[model samples]
Target: MIMPRGSDQLLLPVNPFFIALTLLLAFAFMLLPFGRHPALPDLLAVVLVFWTVHQPRRVGVGLGFCFGLLLDVHQGALLGQHALAYSLLAYAAISAHRRLLWFGVVEQALQIAPLFFAAHLVSLLVGLAAGGMFPGWWMFLAPVIEALAWPLVTIALLAPQRRAPDPDENRPL
Candidate 1:
């Protein structure tokens, strides 16, 4: 099959342990005392979406739900707020996974911007419906920051997969 122009090369099979480690690391990042800044990007969401898109079969809605619940418990927010948002985010990423892979990292970032925005929107709406105070205009910045983070996260996460498994002078794959 002819590969898409945007897909530069084949990737090594993803390691399951690496995926779990990244997810756990993102979760740990969320647990940091960031003072609840409204514009703070959701590193967990960004990482979740990346894995959902890249490894749909391995990382899907269920994982998103579980992590979202954990985040909810951590933040003491409405029970299913992040769960609903993340599940939807994962679903959207999985739905667009095939087409999303055909774009360069930057373009892929732009494409997923709406998904991140929508997830934030869902979270905001849920919070509002629960009578939570508005987090102010800064709330909108999170999704943009998350979108901006896409390329960096993509590059970092894909680094391990980019290395040649069996390097040889004559093999330039």
Candidate 2:
């Protein structure tokens, strides 16, 4: 027998409150003591990409811009550096959302790697233009770390919505 189309939907709704809370948690994680690590992963960017891919309408470039602005203020970086980078990142994610959604999480992670790199590259270029010292070759590490973390993040965020498989498929829940 075929499963009902409605059953394919996640059991839990994607609540905006949870999304906001997750973003706040990611921001706090970013603030944790990394102690001058040049290659720290941007948890905020990862969270942004996660939400953008899963809920494009609710979490788009505007949210990215706001979060990036917050990050800039927190980091004391030249204003608009992260805003520009995250806006670009959101644009890239929005552009690829359809295709990315069709793929498995691992493939999505692979596909998203370049977008993460582009965001970092934009930030680096902006920082350099503003007379900031080069952060070093290790700066490329963040994207790699982010990409690797993508599947794990997806699973974690989505786990609550996943329904348990019916033990008796012959019966409907």
Candidate 3:
């Protein structure tokens, strides 16, 4: 629904408390034990996509870079590796927002998953160029995991935003 005068959209504001809580959650996600798996998916990436596409006014490239840097620190990977990927993801999401919205969940997953794959590839190339060691085939699990969760998470988390505006608010301007 369109917000009334002086009322803001549903996007959450970026405040100190929000930043701190976000950092805490990011850290926890990176460190939480999950039976020797890499969480089978990038929860952090999913989060970035959600905010970037739906509430871009609140979350944009800078925040993606910030979160990616935090993830880099937590994962002990090359700094700026994930940051680049994350910011790129945000850009892609914002650019493709129109096409993405019109597609069904299944169709959207097929499309977005490739972008996720490309992001992973870009990160891998950067790491290699920087002389960072490879983590081997198991690392490829990321895209597959990304593919599986991309649609489910988006549909579950952001579908609310697609709902029609409350009809009673209609009025001639």
**lDDT (Cα, tens digit) per residue for candidate 2, span 57-140:** 999999999988988998889999999999999999999999998888899999999999999999999999999999899989
Tens-digit lDDT string for candidate 3 (78-109): 89998999999888988887788677767877
Best-first order by TM-score: 1, 2, 3
Instruction: Output the number of the lDDT-best candidate.
Output: 1
Candidate 2: which stretches are off by over 4 Å? 4-11, 164-173
Q: What is the C-alpha RMSD of each candidate to the true structure, in Å?
A: 2.1, 3.2, 6.3
Q: Which ten residues in a row have the lowest lDDT in candidate 1?
A: 1-10
lDDT tens digits by residue: candidate 1, 1-173 = 76776757778999999999999999999999989889999999999999999999999999999999999999999999999999999999999999999888899989999999999999999999999999999989989999999999999999999999999987655
Local accuracy by lDDT, each model:
0.95, 0.89, 0.72
* Total residue pair clashes for candidate 2: 0
Off by over 4 Å in 3: 1-27, 33-39, 159-173
Would you list the rank order by lDDT, best first? 1, 2, 3
TM-score of each: 0.95, 0.89, 0.72
Among the numbered candidates, top TM-score falls to 1
TM-score of the candidate numbered 2?
0.89
